[model samples]
Target: MSLHIVGGLLIKRFGKTGIRSVNLLRFRLAQEFLLCFILTKNTFGKIINKTMSKKPSRFHVDESDLWCKNQCGFYGNTAWKGYCSVCYKSLTNRQQSSSHRVHQHASVEKAVSQRQATPELSYSKFADKRRQQSKTNPVKSLFKSTKKDKSEVDKTSSKGHHHLKSEFGAFLESLSRPIYEDISKRVQNFLSKFKLLPVNSTVETWSDAVQDFYQIITEHINVDPIYQTLEETAVENLQDQLEMYLMNRLYNVVFCPPNSNDEQEDLSLQKRIRSLHWVTIQQLEANVNDQDIGVRIALDKSIADIIELDTKTLPKDKLACIVESSRKIFDAFRLSNEKSEVDGGPQSVASADDFLPLFIFIILKANPPRLKSNINYITRFASPSRLNSGEGGYFFTNMCCVVDFIEKLNAESLNLSEEEFDSYMSGRTTAEGVNTVYVCDGLRLIHENNGMIRRLKERQEKYANSVLNLEHKLSEFREQFDEQINQLVLRAPLTLKPKRGKADIDLDHDIPHSLPSPILPQQISNSQI
Candidate 1:
């Protein structure tokens, strides 16, 4: 029943009651309202509990539905694209294996077919088969012989070392003057265009100008009568020579042009590398024999060679130095490996991973002057074919990568603590109480000291030799002087002449007795005696 209707009926039935009876009726109504509220709350709560119990929970998924679609009897995961992780991995692996097997079977069949197609021969038929093969493969045989002859010719040519004669003899004889003049004219024209407004110049423009210049020169060489008689390699060498000549002339203007920031970058990179001088081979995890004297010498030589890069006038020579330095690093690694092998360790060749860190270390130590400018110059002016492949390109790329790495290097990159790195960079004592000196600084100090000692020793030896030589010369001179004096004495011997007295005067020859005769005061003389 509704609470309002019940309360209204109770109020009507108790309408004639007194204040006490009315108060009791009101109390009964309050109790009835309280009881209704409690019963309704209990019923609603039960209903809600039932509804919630009937609803499915996210955690209680059905097992059959959760099973892998492949029926592998394992639970599936959304992460695995509805397949079990194990089954998914197995499926992928099986697919890969099957594909690999198919490829292998195909390759095997192809090999078998090739083998079956070729006829097997005994010694008896070998000569006949060879004759038939030669008859059938005349061009191939010719190519083989040609290749052999070419290789032999290359070997012979390389054996005869002539700095300028062998490579550019023809050019130097006839083509050099005209070619140089043309290159000079072209360079002059090109420079005229950008010499004044260098800020407007771009690398692309410069590259295009160079490329065009090269093309023109190449055409000129090709059409020249002298070039026709030259061998293909000679022609190529001539072209290379011309390129070098042209680049050397252009290097001053094109390399690190006034508007470019190559110099600034070089200085920045140098400073960064100097800061990272404390990065040891161990920190870089470079595979080098730091303790081996030979390896250390090689690395030091490489550092010196890399430093010489700035001094090289030609890009080729600079590239040669880079290649030499890289080779030295490789040799160092090889030496290390050999030493390790001698110590009963496994032997291995140096790989790119091993090369990079050591190269980085070398750069840090060498800190070549105008490094960025050199790199930029080479990249800009070097033959594309040279820089795209071969040792030059590879090592130059590594050098570039090393520079970049140094630029971006930090404590995290070196796997060092920030505090330690800071201490090293600041040249301060670390927590370990060890002051960090850069590798270059320590090496330079050692080198200077050793050089000083060597020079001092040489000076000492030279001074000793000089003193002995002087003493020997002095002895010879003294003996000569003594002999001359003896000869003089012998030639004009000293004779004792009799002392002439006044009484022994020859009156006619020794004295003019008749010239004048003055009378002496004999009395004064007798008194003085």
Candidate 2:
């Protein structure tokens, strides 16, 4: 059955046939070899087909590229050729995801193109549009439109606006309307009921009336049930309002200024008026010294109590209003040069300018934080010009001296004994006195310095101005000298006149007849000498 053995039998059988049968035997051997090759190829092809027909395991499928390359039983799509349909869809998101990315790119390109086309549009417009489109939802534009509508509605529904002048006018009207008549009447009735008023008391003795009212309230608070209801009365909260009213009236009567066209002057006047109370209170304290010690102490205590109570009790909004109104009024007062003779008997009142710094001091003590923000305003008001001038300078220096004293008073180490603290607060070793020493020392310091710093600053400014003026003068002198030199050079003869000969001088020439004696006129004369 071996090809070699079969071939040997055929050749032996053919050897007897001689040379004529040789060709025929060779052709038959060739046919047999071709048949053997065909059968072997068929058998191998069947085995290979059988092996490939079975599905590969997951491990084999992952490791071998041949299965996918041959498209063996895998049905999944692939992006590449010879891959399954499933793989192609997964790799490309069934091709739609790829189209979606392309679509997004196109949209971005379109937006960019739109932006580029309208180059005149500002960046804000593009930003606004982009912001509107930034939301992923399709309804974002609709929401934006609705939001815009709502904002428009809000704007349209708001209350009408009033200018500062108009508002100030309204406030003046309200103030002028007799708001205190009822309270004044109440005070009168209460005083008459108690028979506390003097036999011939009148509204002119209002201070006495107020004092008596306070004394009665203090005396009867525990003993009388009627007085215990003081807090429940309408007048309970009226004290602050009354105090503010009185202060306003005082400013109006004493320091009210005429209108000015200059805006800056107006602003300063307003600031000073706002600050009037500070100075007025200081003046009041000074006047208190003329009274008996008991009255002085009582007055000071009452003043302190009122101020402290107002600070604690007044609503923030009302306080802000009062402060703003005071500022406007102070601005008017600050520019005022006019002085009115106040009706009070015999005490010479200080000028409003003298009180300005004191007013600021009071503000600092009452509400330090409130003044913190307005420091710039205060500084501008107390600037070099104001400080170098008359009464303002005096007051400003005094205020600074006070500040220096306060700084010193607070200089003691943070760990202070109780007695030391009491002494510090009272401004004396005795517990009865409240810190008068600090104020007294500050006044003493003011007296000692006596506008020294202001004078120094004035000198410094003057020197600076003089230096600038000297520089200008020096420049002018140099310019004038240069001009004179240029004029002298222009006027100098460029060349000497040609010497005149006798015959040449006889010829009609443009020489002057009046020649100097130094020059020989006869030699140049037409006639011989």
lDDT of 2 by residue, 474-494 (tens): 999999999999999899947
lDDT of 1 by residue, 1-529 (tens): 7646755676687675654666676678789879887979977776676556432321122435444568865554432344543465567568888999999999999999978896655775888878765554221221122456334323333223254334444565565565546544655565444333333455545755675566666677678764566678876776688676556545655677655678798888788877765667777777566776678778888889999999887778889999999999988988888897799754455666677888888888788999988887776566654654566766776676677677878888777789978887898943221112225557456765776799999999999999999999999999999999999999999999999867644566644677777777655566687
Model 1 bad stretches (over 4 Å) = 1-204, 215-229, 428-529
The runs of at least 3 residues in candidate 2 whose Cα sits more than 4 Å from the true structure, single-residue gaps closed, are: 1-369, 381-384, 410-430, 433-529
lDDT of 2 at 261: 22
Q: Indicate the worst ten consecutive residues by lDDT in candidate 1.
A: 136-145
Residue pairs clashing, model 1: none
